[model samples]
Target: MATPPYPPPPPYVPQPPANRLGGKHKTVLGCGGLLFTFVLIGAIGSACSPTGSETTKKVPGPAVTVTVTATATVTPAANAAAGSPKRAQESAPAPAASAEPVTAKARLSNHVGQQLQAAQDAAQAEGFLVLTSHDATGGNRMQVWDRNWKVCSQSPGPGTLDTATTIDFGAVKLEEACP
Candidate 1:
């Protein structure tokens, strides 16, 4: 038999091109890379997060009457790691028991010209906890951050008073003087 000039056109085969990448493949690959990048960033961020600590004050004991202040720092290897917190415990001497009822009184701290937070801390240290403060300029502003304000004047002045008295402090911003 005589051969045809084009070999019958290789039986008219229809095959797709091998070198070109399709749009669908590109889209799928791009989405997978983006997802991988986001997951890697989240892992790195979680590793750099801060560890935490907590402060606890004064626990009453049955016989010892001990005053304890405990503080602990927590660290997590993974997310909320299963372990005990590192703690520091402190103790103070307790007074002897007595039958007589003791009256409660606190000598007020000289909080004038002092930072509002410091004044509050000092007063609380002296067994006075019922406290209130107001703007001395009649602005009726709230002292959101006590450290930013100063005590211009305090009620009942600085003297020993009953613990029941609600101590009120008149305060102004650190930049302004009392009126």
Candidate 2:
């Protein structure tokens, strides 16, 4: 066999693509995703804030701390008949002595069949500041998420209650039936 003057060309081999997207395209997409995440987070934070104010202002004056204090007085029923409701009276607010829950008169609303969070909101709206809940079935389960629980029963159901009173709510999981 005679040797060729030039070496034979290497056999043709297929090569997979290095990348479906270029570095520049990947970077752009990553940046877009990051920006979207930041915008989402900011929107959630702004929406969840307690107040609608977008910014806070600094006043050049003596810093004063405001405290809310209240007291509730329930008068005995004029008619000592059974099932009669007593009236609640509000006295002058006293100075804040401690971190104890303020005792004010808050009307209690019927919270049965409502979400725990809604129940709490309603109680607060009714002027009841202090509120709490427990497992209605005596399962000893704690309500970790207020929105996931439903109010089965409430203490001192639907009446004028003292703000200082700890409204006890018996709640069950949203999927569970109230006992």
Candidate 3:
């Protein structure tokens, strides 16, 4: 082949552009992208997070107090002889003694040797809760039936004058086979 024109212009080789971004500029862009991704993820997570609807707010005005009083009215008798003292006396009801609310306190009682149901009933009647424990020390287990179980001992023994709301009872089968 004869020298082709300009000797094929010495194979063209590609070169990087002179105005390309520097290393520092690339690093700054990468960091900014990562920060934007993290912020976006955090915002989405917070939007989807579980939260309660109720908001606690303080009242703006002074607290108001209210008092209520009750009154009793007597109804006149319809079939009595016109203006009769006997009728008036019979129609008027006697005034009730000052009514006061009564609260019953639990009085620890001797429940040992008593049936579990009876003990529980007695305790509940006195406004107390009952906690029963099995006494299965000697290979004897408590039965599911309350009546079949007998209390062997009690905590805070009878007449202690302590207002414990809950009384614990140690019980076993009624056969008395267990110590």
Best by lDDT: 2
Segments of candidate 3 deviating more than 4 angstroms: 1-104, 136-142, 160-164
Candidates in order have lDDT scores of 0.70, 0.71, 0.63
- TM-score order, best first, reads 2, 1, 3
Q: Write the per-residue lDDT of candidate 1 for residues 18-114, one digit (tens) a residue.
A: 9577899899999999999999999998776432121223322122122444444433333223343332111212334444544566567567777
Note the residue pairs that clash in candidate 2.
none
Judged by lDDT against the true structure, how good is candidate 2? 0.71
Q: Candidate 2: minimum summed lDDT over ten consecutive residues — where?
A: 54-63
> What TM-score, computed on C-alpha atoms, does each candidate reach?
0.44, 0.47, 0.36
Q: Kindly list the per-residue Cα lDDT of model 2 for residues 29-76, writing each as its tens digit.
A: 999999999999999987896443222222222222336865555444
lDDT (10s digit) by residue, model 3, range 16-47: 77968899999999999999999999999878
Error of 2 at 3 (Å): 3.9
Tell how far residue 9 is off in model 1, in angstroms.
Answer: 25
